[model samples]
Target chain A: MTAINPVEILLVEDNPQDVELTLRAFKKANLTNYIHVARDGAEALEFIFCEGPHAGRKIQNGPKVILLDLKLPKVDGLEVLQRIKRDPRTQMIPVVVLTSSKEQRDVVESYKLGTNSYIVKPVKFEQFIEAVQQLGLYWTLLNNPPTGGG
Target chain B: MGIDFTNNVTAGGHQVADQLAASFKEISDLRAALDEHAIVAITDPQGRITYVNDKFCAISKYSRTELLGQDHRIINSGHHPKEFIRDLWTTIARGKVWKGVIKNRAKDGTFYWVDTTIVPFLNDQGKPRQYIAIRADITARKMAEEALRQSEARLQTIVESLDEGLVVADLRGQLLHFNHAALEMHGYSSLAECRRHFQELPDTFELHAMDGTVWPVGQWPLARILRGEKLHDLEVRIRRINEAGWERVFSYGGMLVNDATGMPMMAIVTISDITERVRAAAEIRHLNTALEQRVIERTAQLEMANKELEAFSYSVSHDLRSPLRAVDGFSQAVLEDYGDQLPEEGRRYLQSIRAGAQRMGALIDDLLAFSRLSRQALERQVVNADALVRAALEELAPLQQGRRIEWRIDKLPACQCDPMLLRQVWVNLLSNALKYTRKRDPAVIEIGCQTNSGSRVFWVRDNGTGFDMQYAPKLFGVFQRLHRAEDYEGTGVGLAIVQRVIHRHGGRVWTEAQVDRGATFYFTLEEGITL
Candidate 1:
């Protein structure tokens, strides 16, 4: 699928520091792909479906992988996952949940909503870096995505 | 000695006259005696009245002329059967004497009983020519006998109709009477099987005590009553020997019945079937126990649910540490990347920022541990107290370095407790003591066990900076601190964790202290008793 301004990775996060740390960790892992950041679940859904402010973007230009933070400002991670998986236009994109909550319900619900991966943001900087690097390496480099248009 | 007229005519009339007079005197005496005691009457052939004496007329309430020509039917009370009257006539007609008791009616239409005798006089052909009937009045004795018999019949009716069983036995335990209900309770459809002596009851049916032990025949209610013991509400379980599984509980009350002269005559017992009552009582007791068990199970479930909820909230605090990680991480990044461009003061300010973030991280970690302790399942085992204390001291060895310290360690006996949690408790207490006594030139800490009221109490005494006793009540509360953070270097969650661990082991913790004097913490684990 080819489109105008196609994206490789989409980052859904509300905390700015977490975003910086995640991007830093990805860079350290040598993953320099074009990454688009959405500050909330609503903005991430808009970007995925090309709605509202993201109407100029093409739905056919879906990201290769989505890194989702569970706790978001307006729309929560589970709802955004549900919207994306329900619509065939963005369902094929792999979503990995990255949140600091180790609550069992959040993990269970994220999986139930069809999240491709779930990770608890570690407390230490080095451990967090390692967790993000491993997930980035596997989802972007190892896993293959379908090129067929929705 | 008939005073024969032929002999008188023949000769010697004067000599026969004296003998005839003596014979007449003897005959008159016999007639007088008969008239004195008996009501007498005479009947001729064909059953016609021929003669009657004054006694007969007086008893029949009739004049002599009124009874003179009447047969015995005139006084018949119609009480005896026809066959009885015919039998009397048959015996007399055959020229034999007849005797019986007869009920006869008097002339005044009243009834009377008579003891009667009839004598027959026969002719030369051996046929009865006349009949002489003699009777005596016996009405009073017969009426008394009738009243007694009617009362006995009434008593039998009452006893048979009772819902409760009544059994009467002689003093020797011989069965006198047992009513219908008594027979039914003994598992008998009829009295045939039950109509034996009380001693034979054990052969067919067995009686058991309340504890389900078979009772000897001597302990049977009948036997007890016969022994002159009065029983009240004595319960026994009974089952037929032939039908092993069938059983019933019976309540018996009885006493030894006495005759009018105060001698023991019979043993009388009353019984009631209490099988259903006993079963219902047992069922109620079982239901109560089950209800109590259900309540305990529900409470445990609620506690588990509450702990899970608390752990989740602390997990949210688990997320709080993430932001602190970023703060500490980015601050180090700033110092490592731009150290040469920043001024020395700015570098020190960044260091302070890192330190503050790290301390907040420690506080959050301690909070998580405190909540985790409440949810942790207590794993108890017998552990040596001395070892737990030494292990905690070894972990605190770094704090004890470069300091003058005196350690008074007492040998501790073994105790049953959660070894891991107890070690944590020792670490918290010893570290608190070591922290507060920093100003002391030579800090003295004592550890020992004292036997108090059969329970082992472990204590830790330290010469340290103790707070006012008024704040003792708040000492173990989470996040409650008496000393400033800069002086104490703690998050104030240590004592709360210690209290929680001790309470889970069915024990208690308390402290005694005076400001700057010293503090001694005492605790005891009484596991398996309070819980």
Candidate 2:
């Protein structure tokens, strides 16, 4: 969870395969290859808030996009999103809720918590890859996020 | 005291003789009157008949020759006992008169009641010489008296046999008569027992009207009737200290009996006990309240359970689909990354794994959707069936692209239903048609609407490999499928979802199919909705 330099994409996924697939999707898009992975919602919060083991990381040097998985082990992804959206320092950071939930309530709640994008990971790898690539490209190179990574 | 009549013949002897003759004439005339007017008869001192007058013979229905020598016993009715005859004889033998009403029998055996008197004629020695009995006919009066007794007996029998309680009271409110049932109704053993306490009926029994208002004694049935009020179906309540110790309800009918002058002389009241009916109605109300309470409790419990079930299924869909996605995704990724390095068998195995994962994913998603169909409340609106069918076909364009699907659409009517749910029904049924009809070269499929028996019917007919009729019953069940997975690529949830949605709108679904023939599925919406 430690990050001294500014990261491009922060991928918060509990499952290892999902994290790997997400990284590969970025690589295929030729988007920011410098992706940092947080295994659970708790570690994602620690990395973003610079607390616990990430105590010395500067809060301003944040990732360009935070890919948040709704289902997580420790603090729920919704709780993590709420913490970021409520905090003035991390409020402007683009948070994309990338999960395997197609539930309407989940989509609505994620958007209500200020998720920049809500995507249901498709079962087919090709579709998932395409969706992730577009998401990465849009947030990193296409869409101009706030300066200082918000 | 004048002189010896034989030696004292004088100058006035001739005159005295003439006066004596006149007195004799008077005595003979009086005897004739008695003989003609009375039923007269004479008996000797030995109680043998000496003579009978003509009047006696006619009244006794006998001839003079038959009655003259016979004693008075010939006309005796045998109704008088020996002591009665002996009393008459004793008085007559003592030279006193005996008089009594006597029943006498005639020669024809017909009887007559008579007022009789007996007198003894004395001899010079003061001994009885003969007895004479005089009688008068009184049978008409006796018959009238007997008829009155019989009439009273009949009235008593009628009053006692009645089912409803009856009470007759005088103008002064004194109970003159009460029947057997009235005693039982008053919790009394008999009329005498009721009469003992009924004198204070206003104090002994508490009375209330049918509406539970306290009723005064002056307004009671008998009292009202005494005041000449004829009432029908008058209900009242009486609180009794006996017989289950509960208040008894009764209905009474009252009538005032007037004398010949038309003045109210008596009050006749009829009462019927209605305790059982009143208590039964109360029991029904109590049972209804209890039943309603139980239903409310059961509904609340079911609602809570349903909420919990919805939550469980939501999480199951979210948690279960994630693994399937990862499996299918990584499998495809592997095949894409290193397919040439592997042998044919290895690539086939990876493809199989990917296919199985994708199937599992479809099953989980459809199952979740089917569960959501039940929990979603219906939002009924006027829905255009034609528009919904076209939209469903448009959504199925991907499946319909590669196949030669011939569409036979119709101008469908609008229905009052939830548009979203009805659209789902169309998608499921239409896609099912498209999927099952894949092998047909022409791939004939028709979507149309018809009405049968005043109900709206919609059908999706496909001319392709159809199912057996024996398995039609299981067609609409969750995860129930007749075809093999290899033959039909479905999660077995399409028809189930269709059935669920149609049922939510108060409709039903069914399918008709035969082996290797086309299948036609029909659905009916609720009746009488002006569809």
Candidate 3:
């Protein structure tokens, strides 16, 4: 396989500790070089649409796999996910939901909104890192993203 | 000269003799007059009866012989006070006349009353000579006067004590007579305060009937009397001073007084206070109106709650089932599509997921059944407990096939209960007995009833894996199971549904159990009655 672009693995997480652990796990799994981070849903949407501070960036060069968190300030994760799925430019991109809420309604709704995978973020740090590493390996190396660029 | 003297003497002597004869005849006639006019009781100054006429003797019921020498004490009736008798004697002895009415006893003990006047005849020096009394029978007159006084007193008392005001007014509206009540009714301290004439009374007073129709004074009792109109029970309302405020009075009147010529001369009005009675009747009407409004409000609230519960049940049935179908169907799809490639653990996990989903579906169905029961209207009938139990046992027989079980059915009485609901109760109870006793070699289930006092109590007793009595309170709670799901296979809603049905029939259910011994459930179709 050809080397993936550096911005292909984008993580939108509010917790700094979660972001650090996710990056460390991805490094151990040999997938950290392509990883990027957005602290909130607004920053993630800006990066994807290439607007505001990233105005000059090409939208078609967005992340190949986006790990989205459902809870965030200003704009919620679900609305961002809905906007991404609705727009054709980001509709084909694989977006996985990582949340602490195990509520049945939330899980069903996430999948119905075209989320590629839904995972409950484990409470223990070690278990959380393992979940992140496994998700990175599956989406990056095993599962194939769309060949058609936006 | 001798011859002239002889003639004069002879004429004078002859005239003197004739004057003496005339005087004798006048004396005899005066004596007869005295006997006819007076009851002559010629007593000495000591009141001794020296002479009595035939009339006196007859009135005294004594002969002259019996009275002649007796003092006046012989005829004393003892009716006079001591001072009265003393005064009478003092006056008569002093040559004075004494007049009095005396009650005296006759010789035969009969009593008679007389008006007597006694005169003391005296000599020229004014010394007492003899006493003479003249008396007449006065019993009839005294009796007549007494009867008249008693009748007047009774009439006065009746007028004073009457609750209604009574007024008598002449045809010209001049007030002739009025009762104490009438004075009070007119807000006056006395009859004089009201007015001697009816027209002088204040016209500021308004008179109306109970329904507020105005009544003219010209149509009042006195006016009716003047017009010769006879009025009876004509209700009129009057304002009267009561305590510090004015009160409303209900009245009726008619003409009662008649003139000397027997014509209607005056009118009488009767009245009473009816304010309290009127107010109480109004209050009752208000309460009844409020009660009706409350009933309407309660009925509306009940309807709203019923609609909400119905909507909730529908959502539970539709919304819950949609997702449940997805869970079961997708798990089935995974097994079918990739069974050959999947590991044994993966197949097992998928099967467990399907099992859990199916169990959830069963729970939802049970919940729906429970909800449906609350809205079902009761159909009442006479249910024979023995027959209902037998039918329920038969229905559960397919699950109890080849099991060694002992059944004891006591004589059960018929009761007034809902048949379908009662049957459901029996099905839940007997099935529970069969299920709990499944581990036993010989399951002993006793279906029986006992007559307790005036009520019949039916019970289902089972020798089974009984639960701790400490957990008895939770036995009928929905989804509250004492044993683990692995130990007992149940939805845990059977007892709850049984309780609901029994309660709707106005009955109660209870249980007694000891761990690993047996359990007995007692129920009654009538509240507060236990066997």
Top candidate on lDDT is: 1
Model 2 TM-score, 2 decimals = 0.63
Docking class of 3: incorrect
lDDT of each: 0.83, 0.80, 0.75
lDDT of 2 by residue, B145-184 (tens): 7799899889888888887899988778888778988877
Ranking by TM-score: 2, 3, 1
Q: Assess the local accuracy of residue B10 in candidate 3 as a C-alpha lDDT between 0 and 100.
A: 38
In the predicted model 2, the residue pairs found to clash are: none
Chain A TM per candidate, in order of listing: 0.78, 0.78, 0.77
DockQ, ranked from best to worst: 2, 1, 3
Ranking by lDDT: 1, 2, 3
DockQ, all models = 0.18, 0.38, 0.02
Backbone clash pairs for candidate 1 read none
DockQ, candidate no. 1: 0.18
Who wins the TM-score comparison? 2
Residue B49 lDDT (model 3): 82
Model 2 misplaced regions, further than 4 Å: A1-13, A33-68, A74-99, A104-117, A122-150, B1-179, B196-272, B278-290, B293-297, B336-345, B402-404, B467-471, B482-487, B503-508, B514-517
